[model samples]
Target: MNATETFDWAAAGESLAESVTLIAGGARGTGRTAALSLLQLGARVAIVDLDPGRIATVAEDFAEYGTDRVFTAVADCTVREDVQAAAAATAEHFGKLTHCVYSAGAYRAQRPTLDIGADEWDLIVDSNLKGAFLTYQAVIPHLQRAGGGALVSISSLAGRTSSPFLGCHYTAAKAGILGLTRHLAKEFGPSNIRANAVCPGGVVGTRMNDLLSELHREQDLVELAKQTPLGRNVHEPDVVGAILFLLSDLSRFVTGATIDVNGGILTI
Candidate 1:
């Protein structure tokens, strides 16, 4: 088969009909979009987020997409007990848990290295790096008990390259996830558990996109796009497609990989 025909995407289409997925921080942004995507693919979903009302609202809005395929939980991925509770609830609600997407990361765009404070550094590190670590620590047992599963961490373009608009700590933490993904792949591959990451560039159509849209100048956006050979920014759907592939058996035997969903951006 050619590169385009490597995996059977049709398997993803219907196999997910009875599948159950647990998404961390799935109430909004890429996380929410991802949850909806998985549900659309026919997976029963339990979306975890920090906001009860927002989760409830989004859960209701997308419930029809899931039919009985959707559910919601209000839990902080950074908090261990909350993660434990959410995982337990997801398994109980769906009657099975097969995939885990650690999509809860924080980003606060600001002036480059010299302009940021110490506390801001800690905040970004704690959220991006520590949060990913916490989610893995809390969910490992669940995945293990399930006997085998797929674990995907959503990273960023900053991990692959430095950006003037994003702080160094954010980039560093995002980069750390790539290393972590490789380590987990080696450690858990024997158990049929695969670990991978999606590194996305400036993504449009998310809360972060709209927020950053307000902060970035047109020239800045264009300059950012220029780094990529594609000459355009990537959309959420583009990144999500790669993510969905990583989560599905379509990428079976693939592990410890960090996929770049950037239009063409790679640090020089």
Candidate 2:
């Protein structure tokens, strides 16, 4: 039997069957999709978001998963207390936390560096970078108590290169996430915790896509897709698959690494 025949494809998802995952900024978009996928894999999930309405709506979406396996917390990821509280609540509700996914970030309209205001920079940086820091800080201890875990941070292709549709602030924040993820992987590896990053290109159905649609002509969008080796922009599932891999034991020995889900648009 070769590697292919020996591989247990059906057991690939079983590694996460006992997982308890917390998704920061999980109310919508890729984060929301991740939550649903985790639940489907037989893992318990806790969703933390800044908006109560989104929390309610996503909770409804997960209603079939039942209350025992799903938890929701409404808190601002940028606030230390809120994030700590949410992490604590998640652990208390789920019994343990085995994985964390930081998908909370913001993007603003494209503008020249000179035209970008200080406030806008601060907001974007704090939301994308500081929020990840806080979420990691709050969850790391819980993971420690649980013996070990994994962390997956959602960065962007903009961080790897540049964004034609967003400002420098978004780029900087996402780039910061890559750095933070590496540092966490180094700092926590001794504790058995793993950390990795996923950089996805312009994903369809995301707010970034909405902004792109508004800013670029149809031909421009087509041109953008044509540039990628895959001949299309990334979709939610493309990124979610990467997230699920990092969260599962399949990536047990993989840490301090980056998996780009950018359809080969920007290869290093």
**Which candidate wins on lDDT?**
2
Provide the RMSD of all predictions against the true structure, rounded to 1 decimal.
3.4, 2.9
Q: What count of clashes does model 2 give?
A: 0
State model 1's lDDT: 0.79
Judged by TM-score, which candidate is best? Answer: 2
Each candidate: what lDDT? 0.79, 0.90
128-189: candidate 1 lDDT, tens digit per residue: 77777787776777778777788889888888886555678889989999999999999988
Consecutive 10-residue window with the lowest summed lDDT within model 1 = 11-20
Residue 256 in model 2: shift from native, Å?
0.6
